[model samples]
Target: MPDNMALIEERLKLYMINLWSRSYYMGTLGNMSKEVVERYIANQRTTKSNADHLSKENSALRH
Candidate 1:
């Protein structure tokens, strides 16, 4: 049903946000996480004009 689909969509969005928040938090935790640093560097090297959504969320959480 439409209601069920809507509920599923909402849950999926929440799950994605949860995952992004965790990833971002882990990335900011410390300098010893080499993998996180490499991933961040790789993301920075990309030519995308818009800011990454998860990065934005991570920054907002910091303040």
Candidate 2:
């Protein structure tokens, strides 16, 4: 029973994280896409050169 409770708690934490991340990311997808596309446009923004790169953008939560 204790083990099951622990598993449930862990899963709940994961679920909440996933839910919050999805909501946060999806909400600004429209605006994000605009800013995001600029990166791909090449020499159009601050990060010159079009190249694939892993990025983690957490703009202090717009909403």
lDDT of 1 by residue, 13-63 (tens): 999887764235554567666786778768866734345766788899999
Quality of model 2 by C-alpha lDDT:
0.56
What's the C-alpha lDDT at position 15 in model 2? 93
Query: In each prediction, how many residue pairs overlap at the backbone (N, C-alpha, C within less than 3 A)?
Result: 0, 0
Per-model TM values vs. the true structure: 0.35, 0.34
Residue 59 accuracy (lDDT) in model 1: 96
Off by over 4 Å in 1: 22-63
lDDT of candidate 2 over 1-63, digit per residue (tens):
999999999999999887764223445446556656555444444353222221323333433
